[model samples]
Target: MSRLFVTGRSGFVGQHLEAALLVLPTADWQLIESARFDLLDPASLDAALAETCPDAVIHLAGQTFVPEAFRDPQRTFEVNLLGTLNLLQALKRRGFSGTFLYVSSGDVYGRVDESDMPIAEHLMVKPRNPYAVSKVSAELLCQQWAYTESWRVMIARPFNHIGSGQNESFLVADMARQLVRIKRGLQAPVLHVGDVDVTRDFLDVRDVVAAYLLLLEKGQRGEVYNLCSGVERRVSELIMDMAHLAGVTVTFKQNPGKFRRAEQRRVVGCSEKIQKQTGWKPHAEFSETLLSVLSDWEVREAH
Candidate 1:
C-alpha cells in the first residue's frame, strides 16, 4: 500500500480526484487528510507530513478563483507561492524521497495569439491575471526544487474542467445554474452570459483526475504536461447545449459585469506529450458531460 497526501481535498477538482482514487483498481492507495493542515502554517504542514509519510503528494490547494485573486493579489501570492515554499521546506526537512505533482493552470499561457491555438508546454508563459501569475511563480519554484533538491516533481497545466459540485463562480457552472432555474420556472428563459465568442479547451473533471493519476505513475520528473481535451470549444456552443439539455429555449443577454477585459479570445492546448508518455486520453463525451453538469445544477436548485 502506498500513502498519498493530497492538498485541497475538499475543493471541486480535489474532491473528484479523491473519489477517482478510491475506485481505481491498482495499488492500495491510502489518502492523508489535509483538513487539519493549513498550507500557510509550516508547523501544520510538517505535522501532516510527519504523520502520513506519503509516498506521493498531489498539491491542489491554492487560491483558485481569478476574481478573488484580482481582489487580493498579496493573499494569492502568499497562499500559492509561499504556501508551496513551506510545503517544500517541510518535505525537505523530513528527508522525503517521493513523487510530487503540482497542479497548475493553463491560465499561465494568458492572452495567447490565434497562432498559438494549441499551446504546448514550451510556449512562453505570459500570465495575465494575479491567479495565473501565482501559478507560474509556483511552477518555477517546483522546477527549482526538482533540479536542485533532486526531488521527483511534475507539473500539470490543466485547462477548464467542468463537472458536478462545481460552484457557480465558473463560467459553465454559472450557465448550467441559470439554465436549471429557467427549466424549473424559477427564473426567466434568458441566460446572462459573458464573452461567449471566446473559445477554450475543456475536459471533464473526471478525465482530468485520471490524467493526474497517470502522470503520478508515468510522468517524467521535472517535466510539464498539459491535461486538456485538445479541442477548442466555444462557450456559446456549451450554453446552447445546456439549454437544450434542460428543455428550455433561452435567449442570451451579454452581461458586461461578467466579462473580463483581459480575457483571451481563444485558448487551446496540445496534450500530445502526456498521451505519448502515459497513454492517457479524454474519454467523456461532450454532450454527456454537459448533461451531467446540468443534472447537478438541477439537484442543487431543487434544494
Candidate 2:
C-alpha cells in the first residue's frame, strides 16, 4: 500500500480530501494519520517523517486565516514559510525523494485588472496580506526545492473553494449559516453582509480534491496549476441563490466590519493549466453544491 502523508487534517479541504482518499478506486493508499505535530518544532516534524516514511506527501498545513495572520505575522511566517523549510530539511535528512504537493492560494494574485478577468498562472503575484505573502514565500521555497532536488514537487493555487465545514470567517459560509439560523427562527430575516458586488471564481471543495488527486498522478514536477471554475460569479448572486435554497426572503444590511480593506472587486482564475495538464476540470453543479452547504449548516445548527 502507498503511504500518503498529509498535513492540516483538521481543515475543511483536508477533511474532504481524507474522505475522497478513503473511497478512491485505483490505488491502495495507506494515509498516514495526521497526528498533531507542531510545524514550528523541527524535531516533531523529523520524528513524524522518520516514523511514517511516506511515499508521498500533500502539504496543507499553514496559517490559513487571513485576519489571524494579520494579528500575528511573525507566527504566520514561522509556520507557513519556516515550517515548510523545516519539513523539506527533515525529508532530506530522511532520504525521502517522492512527490510533494504544496497547496498555495489564489490570493497571491492580489489585485488584477478587468482585462485580466481570468488570471492565469503566469500573472505576476502581488500579495497584499500577510497570509498571501507567506503563501508566496512558501511557493518560492517549494519551487527552489523542485529546481535543485530530485523530488517531484508541484504547486496548486486554488481559488475561492467553498463547501460544507468551511469556517464562518469566509463570507459565503457565514451567509449560508446565518440563513439557516434565520430559517430556523433563531434570528431575524435580515442578512448582515459585506461587499456583495464583487465577483470571484469558485470551485467546490469536492472538485478541488479531485483535481489534487489527478495532479498526484499526472501533474508535472515543478509546475504550478490554478484550480478554479473559470466562471465569474457575483457574491450577490450567491447570496440570492442560498436564500432561495434556504426558503428565506433576506433583506440585506451592509456591515462595514465585514468588508476587507484591499478586497479585489473582481477576481476569477483560469483552470486551463491544470485542465490541460492533468485533464482535471470542475464538475460539481453550482446549485447542488450550494444546497449541500446549506444542508450541512442546517444539520450543524440543529444540534
Candidate 3:
C-alpha cells in the first residue's frame, strides 16, 4: 500500500477528499493527516514526516479566507509562505523523493479582463489580495523545490467550489444558511447579499476532489492545472435557485458591509488542459449541487 501524507485533512475540502478516498475500490492507498504537525514549527513537521514517511504529500493547509487574510496579513504570510518553506526544508532534510501536490486557488488570477473570460493556465497571475498573494508565493516556492529536488511537484488551482459541510463564512454556504433560517421561521424572509452582479465558475467539491485524485495519479511533474467547470453563473441566479430549492419565499437586500471593494466582476476558468490529460470532467448537475448544500444547511439548523 502507498501511504499519502495530507495537510489540512480536517478542513472543508480536506474532509471531503478523505471521505472520497475511503470508499475507493482500491485498497492500495493509506492516508496520513498532518493534524499532529504544526506548520509554523519545523521540528514538529520533521518529526511528523519521519513518523509517516509517506510516498506522496498533499499540501492543503494554508490561510484560505480572503477577508481574514486582509485582517491579518502577517499571520497569512507566516502560515502560508513560511509554513510551506518549513515543509520543504523538512522534506529536504529527510531526503524525500515523491509526488508533492500543492493546492492553490483561482484567486491567483486576479482582476482579469472580460476578454479572458475563461482563464487558462497560460494567463499571467495578478493576485489582488493577501490570501492570493500568499498562494502565488507558495506556488513559486514549490516550483523552486521541484527544480532543485527529484520530487514530482504539481499545483492544482481550483476555482470556487461549494458543497455540503462548508462553513457559513463562504458565499454559497452563507446563502444556504440564511435560506434555511427563513424556511424554519427563525429569521425574516429576506436574504442579504453583496455584489450579486458578479459571475463565477462554481465547481462541486466532489468533482474537485476527483480532479485532485486524477492529478495525483496522472498529472505531469512540475506542471500546473486548473480544476474548474468552464460554465460561469451569476451570483443573483444562484441565490434565486437556492431559495427555490429550499421552497422558501425570499426578497433580496443589498448588504453594503458585505461588499468587497476589489471584487472581480467576472471570473471563469477553462479545464480543457486537465480534462485532456487526466480524462477528468465535472459531472455534478448545478441544481443537484445547490439542493445538496441547502439540504445540508437544513439538517444543521434543525439541531
User: What would the TM-score be for candidate 1 when compared with the true structure?
Assistant: 0.97
Question: lDDT for model 2, on a 0 to 1 scale?
Answer: 0.90
Off by over 4 Å in 2: none
Go through the candidates in order and give the clash count of each: 0, 0, 0
Compute the lDDT of residue 94 as modeled in candidate 2: 83
Local distance difference test scores for all models: 0.90, 0.90, 0.91
**Residue range 165-246, candidate 3, lDDT tens digits:** 9989899999999999998899999899888999999999999989888888889999999999999899999899889989
Worst-scoring 10-residue span by lDDT in model 2 = 27-36
Per-prediction TM-score? 0.97, 0.97, 0.97
lDDT of 2 at 77: 95
Candidate 1 residues 1-303, lDDT tens each? 778888888899989988987788884668876447888999998888776578888999999999889889999999999999999898888888899999999999997877877999999999999999999999999999999976789999999999998999999999999988888888899999888998989999999999988988899999999999999988898789788888899998998988875788888899999999999999999999999999898889888
Question: CA lDDT of 289 in candidate 1?
Answer: 94
Which run of 10 residues does model 1 get worst, by summed lDDT? Answer: 27-36
**Model 2 lDDT tens row, 104-178:** 999999989888768999999999999999999999999999999999999999999999999889878899999
